[model samples]
Target chain A: MSMMKIGGWIKRILVLIFALVYLAPLYIAVVNAVKPYDEIIKSPLTLPKQFTLNNFVEAYQSSNMLELYKNSIVITVSSVALLILLTSMAAYIIARRKGKVYQMLYVFSLAGIMIPPVVTLIPSIKTLSALHLLYTMPGLLLFYAGTYFSTTIFLYVGFIKTIPASLDESAFIDGANPFTTFFRIIFPLIKPCTATAIIFLGMWIWNDFLNPMYILGFRGGKTITTGIYNAIGAYTSMWNLVFANVMLASLPIIILYLCMQKMFMQGLTSGAVKG
Target chain B: MKHNKLYDTLFLAPGFLVYIIFMIIPVIMCFLYSFTNWDGISASFRFIGLKNFVNLFQDASFFQALKVTLIIMVLTTLIYNILGIILAALLNDTGKLLGFSRSAIFIPTVLSAVVVAFIWSYVMQTNGGVINAIIEMFGGTKVDFYATPMTTIFMISGIICWNSLGFFVVIYISTLTTIPQEIYEACKVDGAGWFYRFFHITLPLLAPGITINCILSVAGGLKQYDHVKVITGGGPGGATQTVTLFGVEKAFEYNRRGYSSAAIIILFIIIVIFSIVQLAISKKHEVEY
Candidate 1:
């Protein structure tokens, strides 16, 4: 009994320490984001003596902060919209399916789960150029559809299979088309899947770098990531501006994450375990 | 049935077609082109057979990239799975502190790697870098973590793990929620020690989470480019280069599409092999409920 008590104490301390080490970077980022460059370098771990907004103000202006935010929002929202519609439909069919053809289609869609985005990075250029969709929002939307098709479909398929098919058949009996049945009846039932997609794809597309860098072609529109990256590149040694840029870049998504903790965790676990 | 067949064809065709053309075909094309001498701009290039592979074998940059990539895979996977499970167990309960930590850790996971990279680079900088500043506050030398590619890659690897560990922890935490409390209660009554309970009860039950986390970590680590690219740009003469970075540089920067394709194909094979091996090992340990 005594030994168990001793062991539990030690385990608790170790876990506490490990959690801090794991979280050190985020803690460091928050600390430095508010400090002056000189103070930041001198006392990184210390609390800020005086809060200043110059770095963020300058970082915002230089990084095209508003434009970047707008671009990121549009891209993430649009792609996720396309993804939910297309993927959930495919997943609906595949999940109701038990035959060989359906299973093959289901598995075919799931096969994209393994091909890393890098493998397609170059070839996407070729495909995109051929389609005349390169360097356009629609082109990148198609890319996300292709890139995340398997994973998102996997989530929808898992959730859909557990949903009763009789609900759909009855809806069909009530003069509903497959599209109507899916969009009106089935889609709402799959709120869990939508939650998963919104969280997963929103996070991914919002934070994506490589595809946007090449596909977006460095002009016209820039997502938050590539925009901030370019901003930092210009300010290479100016740590103050970079830290300011980082905070601005992550602000929206971090706020969303904090607010939707349960949905985010549920969404992640479903996607991870199902895949 | 007619409508059924049509819907199947209509819905399936567009999404699947786009996916296959953009994703699957490109990957296969990448595989085929890697064996040739195509400079991407040329109208045509010959099938040089295994020559690109041979050249890749001889390229010191390729070897350095492989080293860096493998180190990242091992380090991030280790850090993610180990620390993830621990965090899940610790904060699985409901509390102000636990809830706050859970929310806090998961916040970084949502931000883009570009953003995370830029942030960490600022924090890890030598002069005004937050990490060194903190070290100096305790009278320690302010070390330049990125002075060498070796040090830089490790720091990047650590940062990458930090960015991802949040997602994995939330997954583990959710999985933990699904575990029945009665099992733990029964084990405690059996005089099972914490280590014994963890090894015997918790670990086996966490198999599903383990398989998922391992596969995701390996794939994520294998394709690590964005953070590293933003952090080092595969710099110091490509010493911190990863396979993805090498392949991207080959295709976009150097316009060596064929060589880039070959590198991606190799990475594809590596990911497949690693997944298969992990699947087999983890499946063997799955204790049936």
Candidate 2:
């Protein structure tokens, strides 16, 4: 009994140590964000002598925090909303229907999952420019919709399958049309699957950097990721400002993850494990 | 129930329209563009038929970018999976420490790659950087992480792994939870040790998770852009340039859309090949219960 107790304590201690090391970069970013430049240079590893919020204030102005938030929120919200609605509706059909055409469509959608975003990015620029949608928020939003359509549909199809066809059949028997049946009964029942889709798509669209950097060119409005990258590019050596920008860009998402930690983990693993 | 053509068309048409135009058409266009000598800005160009691919084969920088991309891909994939499994196994217990550790590890995974790269660049900087600060405090020499392109690429790969290993660990942990306790219990009854059970039982059961994680990581690593871009911008004469970065620079900076399309298509092919091979291998190794 004593030996087992000792072994358990050893494992706990080891885990604690590993956690600290894992969190060291974040700790450094937080501590240095509050310190003056000289203080950080003098002792990067030490606790702040005098904590200040000046860095946050300066970072907010320079990075245009409000505009960044607005742009990121609009893009993320619109992209995810569009993704869930379109993919779920498409998935419902794909799950319910039978025939070579539906099977072909399902396979066609899955093919998008294998194609990296970069594959489409180059040619899409031409397509967007031709449509006069280049360097716009709507342009980026549509790009994301197209890019993630496969994975989102894959998740929804798997989930919509477990929901028996009887529900849809009953709704149809009640003199409702297909759209009415899907919207009233089927959609509401797939709340858990929708949550999984929302969380996964939300995180990806929010954190996306490369697609926005290109599709939304310099003339386009800035997102949190690209805005911060541009802001910090000029001041590479300004550790205080850099850390502050990093914190601002990350804090919202981190807080959201913490509050909904369970959902985040479940949503992430569900798409991977099941698909 | 009879199938309603109107409802089917209404439901599928909107999403398929956006998807085909933006996703499918572009992929087809990428292949079509590779055959031409289109210089992005011009509306007119002649078909060059395999010239871009032939040129890509001859371009030294393309090969360099391919080498750098492969190095980062292999290194990050191995680290994310190997270290991920170990961390998941160690933190699989149901204790406060385990919970705290899991959350701490996963926190970075939520942050943007650009943000994570910036923070790591600060941590790994030569002068007064956190890692160097600690080393110097202990009477050790400070290492310049950006001493060479190879070193910088390797360090950036490590940072990418650090940022994403949490994600892999979480998936592994979820898979771990699915394995029955009876297997390990039986192993213990037979005098099997921790390593013995882990190798024999835990790993085989975890193969499904391993397959998914490997495919995701390999595709992700091959398409790496944000972190390397933020850290090095593939600088010092394209020393640390990834294939994606190379293709982007070619398309945007040099306006060689045709050539750049060819470059990315090659990368696309590599990713597809790797994913298919991994799925096949993992499927073969997957133990049936």
Which structure among the candidates has the greatest TM-score? 2
Candidate 1 lDDT, B1-289, residue by residue in tens? 2346887777677778878887788877888888888897877889999988988999999999999999999999999999899888887865455566667677677877887787777777787766676687799998989778888888999899878788888888877777789999998898887789887878888988888899989988999889888888899889999999999899888999988888888999999999999999997987777
Highest lDDT against the true fold, candidate: 2
- Write down the C-alpha DockQ for each prediction: 0.59, 0.81
lDDT of 2 by residue, A118-185 (tens): 88999999889889999998899899999999989998898898999998888888899998898999
The sequence of per-residue lDDT tens digits that candidate 1 reaches over residues A1-275 is 79866755665566556657656776666767777888865666777887888888888888889998889899989999998888888888888867898888887888888998988878787778888888888988888889999888888888998899889889878888888888888889999778978888888888888889898877648988889888889868777687788888877777777777777777777766653
Provide the TM-score for each candidate, comma-separated. 0.93, 0.99
What digit string (tens of lDDT, one per residue) describes model 2 on residues B1-289?
A: 9988998989999899999999999999999999999999987999999999999999989999999999999999999999999999998889888898999999998899999999999899898778888888799999999999999989999999989899999999989998999889988999998899989999999999999899999999999999999988999899899999999999989999999999999999999999889998998998877
Q: Which ten residues in a row have the lowest lDDT in candidate 2 chain A?
A: A266-275
